[model samples]
Target: MRLLPAALSAAVLGAVLATGACGAASADPRVDAPVPAAQVAPAAQAAPAAPAAAQEVLPQRQAAAPPRPVSSGGASRAPVSDPGMDAAADGLRPFLLTPAEIGPEFTAGEEPRPDPATPAPCGGPGVVAQFPFAVRVGAAAESANGLVQETVSVYGDEAGAAEAYRASVAGMSCSEGRVDGRPAVIAPAEDLRADLGHDEATGWRIGGAGFDVVMISVREGEVVMNFTVLAAEDGLPALPDPLTVAKAGTQKLLG
Candidate 1:
């Protein structure tokens, strides 16, 4: 082989020596040193994840109350049964007539064949009687000859009064009608008995004009009172007004 240049030969020799030195450092315990705690890299630490966002909850809603019922006329109505009647009777006794004051001889009869053209005591075309009876505090009398008429009798007791009133009306030609604002049986009659409620009697001989009649008999306290009314053959044009007047008069006389 030809001789190499001095520079190349020297470079090759230095590379070989460096390689040998590196291999020796790796293999030899004396040349290698242990790694220090500070020099060694520590394991990477993971940061805590951010807290999850809080959920929002809504409150539950409550139910509403029901509505009340209304009437057809928009008015509140009263119950059919009432306890006020008995109470009123009890409180109003002091103002009523007693039975003793009303004499037993009171009678209801037709005027005998009065002149047809002449006006009657009641200021009507026919002569009809206004029978009188005693009440708790006042006296009252009623005539016959109206659209509806009434006759009354007062018995010693309530049962007697009711019976007499029913019987007297039953014999007459008229139908039932309310009396003293209460449902009652009315009839047509010329005379009525003086008992509990017999204002309208049978075989009444009156001038041809017909009349409607009402009868009432009330037993308040120790008194038995009778009330009757005679209305024109025509129904009372003022209905309750006439009845009211009759009732007021009775109360005044009896109480």
Candidate 2:
């Protein structure tokens, strides 16, 4: 079966509301490549709709969009029961963060296939995901920050998972790299520390001229998960704590 690489087409470009112009009540920033608005999911998790008068006073932010679901062979966001695969071995869907876990400001992001120039955290000629599914969420595609991206690759054995984690850490130590199409510097994220409830974990800070990203990865048995949180043109306030978020995502994936 063909493995569907990470592609968050749903809200990849969701526009961050132009807060200052919109007079946003919350002290937060907005999105980068805004999605067409037509494809955004409902705002059930977003803050309650402001009173008409309140909205009138502050510029309205773009509606929050959740990340699109991913699965092997480009399957639907929702995980399905595959007769060939046991639920215990279903690695794609359960490895990702749930909508409720991500909160409101974020929307689904459309992710392009990895650019060859961009180095994978786990170095290799290329990535190998036996069964891969990914979710990328952010305020905007281009200029906003707090873009959270998670990709899970499940191998059939623990050794493969361990090697992937080791290789990714080695690859992630580079001094220079690219992120979200921008030139960036890669370094240890020493300040953003956390125990992460387990082992085989590491993190990096990718700094670009227009954006910054915090990337963390952890391995559980046959599964290795990577999390990247971006701070784009807007900022990071709109999103939740990166370490905290990663920890929660890890639990779900391992749970």
Candidate 3:
């Protein structure tokens, strides 16, 4: 999902920027390319003939490319969601969190749009590459015990949904750093029970520097769904279970 909203308790650097280690780790040992027997035979036969002036060439390693932001419209296609996101409403409504779900004082905020006054994670391509269509809605309250929740729905083909899922996992796995000067850390969920996505998922809790947040994103057939809930550290009722919210939304979206 996008990072925390401006209403976020902490004055963070925001969210989703510098968190975890970038690449995956491996344990296999590097092997050298084999030399032609005939080429090495003469050198072996002779007393290691005087070291040749020409040096043996080695394979060069290429640098890993940075994650490219997903773009829209090109020579071949109009855009991911070329026609528009008209059909996205049905898929997004289920995930919308209501004021009742939080506290009575909390009221519905503005619906998430392409360019909202507050920085929101509504862009499909940025978070999940090639997610042609997406929509989001949020709720907020300014009472002493405040709360914030944003639900995002992304629509695409099966492959697009999978790509989004992978990105979310990486985001949570590697999330760590300071936003707006407050510390942020994302730890794997200890008990995520939702039965959504390709396989069971690793839930996430984002907190530190007075911010309390929980997030989860899942993929089903052709849609990727995300839910994030936040509240001040000293708030009354604690943040509800994110997975529960996700399951409820998935049922409606799929139905």
Estimate the TM-score of every prediction. 0.24, 0.53, 0.52
The lDDT of model 3 is: 0.34
Model 2: how far is 127 from its true place, Å?
A: 3.4
lDDT of 3 by residue, 1-255 (tens): 423222333334234423533232222111000000000011100000000110011111122111101111101111244334433443344434466664565555433222211111211223423333443222222223333334344434556545655644543453453221233454444334334554434445554434445555545554444454444432314444455656655454443
Cα misplacement distance, residue 245 of candidate 2 (Å): 0.9
Give stretches of model 1 more than 4 Å off: 1-226, 238-240
Measured by lDDT, the strongest candidate is 2
Per-residue lDDT of candidate 1, residues 1-255 (tens digit)? 211101112233234333431211111000000000011111101111100110011011112111010000000011122244223333443333332232232232221111223222112221111111111111222222121112112223545434433433332333222111111222234332232222322222111011222333333332333333333223223233333433443445342
Better of 2 and 3 by lDDT: 2
Write model 2 residue lDDT over 1-255, tens digit each, in one string.
Answer: 111112212132122221112221232111111001111122111221111212222112344321111111111121234443323334344445654567664454443232222224222322323223222211112213234555554545667556655555555555543332223345543422346755566665543333334556666666555565554323444456657776877666565
Order the candidates by lDDT, highest first.
2, 3, 1
Query: Among all windows of ten consecutive residues in candidate 2, which has the lowest summed lDDT?
Result: 31-40
Candidate 3, after superposition: displacement of residue 167 in Å? 1.2
Going through the candidates in the order shown, the clash numbers are 49, 30, 7
